[model samples]
Target: MPRRSRKPARPTACPCGTGLPYAECCGPFHTGAAKAPTAEALMRSRYSAFAVGDESYLLRTWHPGTRPERLGLGDDRRWTGLEILEVTGGSPLHTTGTVRFRADYADAEGPGSQAERSAFERIGPDWYYTDARHFTP
Candidate 1:
């Protein structure tokens, strides 16, 4: 019997609401073809990762100090969109930065949103997510 060959599916539009397809937007970053140059970009890619349940990409982009031993995504939750509210630093020359954004989703309970101010650090031309302070409203 011949073994079946598994092929990767084509990437669709980015869930971060960039309007561009995933291959043109965050896919490069997620696949290591490119790196996020700013905190805001990293935040967007991270959100996209969550929507697709890409735990490996999420952990790889997270700061080692804060990254958990493992990551799990709830199948019951469906991520819808992302809105970037604000950004500070995280530029090409900056070493640290913050991004404030809202991620919309729906779960077993109902539709809801998460607002967070995420911190990022630039280490040798790469941006890594450090932590976040979640907000309620």
Candidate 2:
């Protein structure tokens, strides 16, 4: 029997709910091909990274001042959705901003959601996630 070569799977829609393909959406940011231009975009990319378990992207995009020494994303949890509720500042001309969102997920315990107001800071042309105030809903 002859061996058949398999092609790579195509990228799917972004997990951030942007209705766009992953390559045109968060893939660039994940690959360092581009930087997120706004706070909301950074937030979306961050959520997408979580969905795909890209720890390096998450750590690299996190602000050094507040970034933890390490991050542990267990394989047991599956991120299901992202909803952006609010955005402030984070413009092409602004250096600071915030994004409020709800990221839903499922684990052994069942389904749950995490709502947060995350702060971001821009250095030169790049946006970095600073910290977040988590909330219960």
Candidate 3:
């Protein structure tokens, strides 16, 4: 039988609002192939994980000090979008950082969004989500 070459699969859009392909954006972070380079990057990947219901990734990126035993991700909620409001000291030269963001979603009731300022810490080469404080307004 004659052999035929297969085409490479097309890249899908990432849900992190970065205007980048999932494979080049958050896919590698989700699959353990790579680590987010900054706190903002980690925050973006965490949002993508929640959108895709990758509870494991969420937990993995969470700081062990604050990571819960498990997550209760409900299928009822559908993540819609992510907006990064601000980023502070999250570069490669920083050991700690903060990211303020808003995440939109929809469920049985209606559309809703959550805003928060998240804290991140770099223990070694990887950044981990430490905590977050909800925004009121």
Candidate 4:
């Protein structure tokens, strides 16, 4: 008898719009298996966290000075997509950076989007989300 090889499972698309598998793109960052290398990466991971309602990961990567004591990650909204509009600094050598983005969502009311230019700071080797300057949605 001949041996047969099992096919690998297909990967699910990451909600961050990276066109990559969730496991490869944001799963490691969410699970603490790996850290985001750049500020934009962190922002992408944060958006993914929101999409999946991983509040712990969101708080963990937030700047301690700004992190909320607790989160209410309810099921009222379903995060649909992310759009990275702009990026500044956020390199390995820079301590600060900004990422402008729009996060799309759908709720009982209807589909909507939130746009903001977010700031990030690097403390040691890890990047943390600082805050955002909101734009009219």
Q: Model 4 over residues 29-125: C-alpha lDDT tens digits?
A: 9989999999999999999888887888999999999999988787788888898999999999999999999999999999999999999999999
Alpha-carbon local distance difference test for all models: 0.87, 0.90, 0.90, 0.90
Tell me the alpha-carbon RMSD of every candidate: 3.2, 4.1, 6.3, 7.3
> Tens digits of per-residue lDDT for model 2 on 85-114?
989999978999999999999999999999
Those runs of model 3 whose alpha carbons end farther than 4 Å from true positions after fitting are 1-11
Q: Model 2, which residues run further than 4 Å from truth?
A: 1-11
TM-score for every candidate vs. truth? 0.90, 0.90, 0.90, 0.90
Instruction: Report the lDDT of model 1 for residue 96.
Output: 97
Mind giving the per-residue lDDT tens digits that candidate 1 earns over 1-34?
A: 9974332343598888999999999999888999
At residue 36, candidate 4 shows an lDDT of: 95
Off by over 4 Å in 4: 1-11
lDDT of 3 by residue, 1-137 (tens): 98743322323989898999999999999999999999999999999888888888999999999999999887788888999999999899999999999999999999999999999999899999999999963
Stretches of candidate 1 off by over 4 Å are 1-11
